[model samples]
Target: MPTPGVDRWTFGVAPLAQTVELAARLRRVTGLALSLEHAAPELDALLDALAEAERRLAPLASADPAPRVGAAVDGDGRVYLDHSRHIGAFNPGFPEYEIVVDGDQATGTVNFPVAYEGPPGLVHGGFLALFFDAAIQHHNCDAGVAGKTAGLELRYRRPTPVLTDLRFVLTRSLDGGRIRSTGELLAGDVRLCEARMDAVQGDRARLPPVSPRREQPGPV
Candidate 1:
């Protein structure tokens, strides 16, 4: 059993609003550029601009010792931690997915854009495993008990298509000091993959304390 109202790890940490915005913009740009069949010569100037931006921010980034992994305060004065699908405030790699928890079950919808395609419009297998891990942890964190993943097993049942709407469902159980979660990635009625995980149950108060971060950089 877990304590009620105890602090749990969360997502949506909007640290440095401008920086997050820049990350979103970079994400969009990366998608657009990757989908293009040929590169425009004009992009050379864009590359140069990006290089200059990187050069300018390098020193400031080196000076900042604060880690971006843990908790941080957002613009609204509320505290949040960014272990969600979006990852860190400046990270644009992970595709954001929707999830909702009710009792022992969690349901979510996600779309894999073209950027995540691996084989002829199919999402890469590795990313599917990543999604299961994140989704499981997200479910646990939201359910008031969570822990480190002791083990994870994934089975690819079918080719998961990209640029399409997909759904995921997870059900968890607490047993003998461990959290056991099982879930599947589905496209409509078809199951694309299945995940089973064993995790060591953890306490909310055991999560790391919030730390200060400076020099949060925008897209560079």
Candidate 2:
């Protein structure tokens, strides 16, 4: 059986798999755009080609299909942002972090490329917060405290460097159905950031019934 929040569609959804691959390629392209030097005068041609490609692809927007599942919260058992297309996804368009769960604890690892840089060689602070948020959510779900984030607090201890692997761990507790979680980001033995988060228990009752079907109209 797959983990509760992990998407089984990862193996079966053709369009999603293709989209994930395309996003991975774009991430590499973004890193190259950020770190490439001007020794070669190819930027102009590259920009022109990108612009033409954008124009050619713009028409596909109108043809985009609606999502197959429309559950509002993760606990509804629908594939969503955390496992699908959001920045926190295991998919390639985002951090592409690897996570493991052990009881009430969750551990994750990620690497930031030049495209995620902010100050010189360091990772952006906002991205660090995003990482913590995702980690907390994963920990909460794995601990069986499914909910939506109500508040998040973060502290930056040092500059997180880019193009290097980083580690994060989260521990969670529950009180009155609210989840309280803490997470930390580290580089080897060095701590970089810390986070505390609170989430309210979601109402699973709002989710649609299993095997729901549209009512057919009778002949007039």
Candidate 3:
């Protein structure tokens, strides 16, 4: 019997088997050829609704002034920053760093503080890169793959304020055994940054294999 709560439309006995079954089922149900170029209104609507809900409830639900999850670690590493909660906030003045990982895509937001300013009240460029890198890396992680920053290209169109809402989106993952991702940072309707990044599968040797070693080296 199929596992409870597992949708026949999305999964099967085996994960790979489920993909094939889902594809066939989709074709039969929609009567449309499946391709990246195709867009489904229903699916789009659902995704939009989810994003909207996330945005609306972010402030209230994430107002807890505590660190629930740490930074991205290979096998569970923990790191904290003051703005961590602000980045993943489910409530106002909170962090919305929590990502919605879906296959090859991931999306999240962050609300910076005045302390993050570089020029007057604008966010620093280095900080923007950090946010972009983390979001992209998290995308890969959510896909069951961990990737390293092989290369990153960023363009700053406008200055991002320290105390403002920033929306991030990651997309366009290529095959080639390596994951290639792109992201964007937006403040309201204005685009602040555009970034493209390449990440390879998480390998121990490539990403400092040991987590505890780095976490605590015991006094050199």
Angstrom error at residue 54, model 2:
2.8
Strongest candidate by lDDT: 1
Compose the digit string of candidate 2's lDDT tens values, residues 47-98. Answer: 8888998899776442423333444222323232333223433244346577
lDDT of each residue in 1-220, candidate 1, tens digit only: 3343454455335457777788678867777788778878767878999999999977655343444434433222223436733452355666668887886798999887766779998999888887788889878887877889999999999999988999999999999999999999899999999999999987755566554444445888
Query: Candidate 3 vs. truth: CA RMSD?
Result: 18.5
lDDT of 3 by residue, 78-173 (tens): 322322112222222222254665666667777765434578878788878877776776565445555557899999999888667778888856
Model 3 CA lDDT for position 8: 13
- What does candidate 1 score in Cα RMSD to the true structure? 5.7
Clashing pairs in 1: none
**Candidate 1 weakest lDDT stretch, 10 residues:** 72-81
Cα-based RMSD of the predictions, in order? 5.7, 6.9, 18.5
Query: Rank by lDDT, descending?
Result: 1, 2, 3
Alpha carbon deviation, residue 51, candidate 1 (Å): 0.9
TM-score for each model: 0.80, 0.73, 0.50
lDDT values for all models: 0.76, 0.67, 0.57
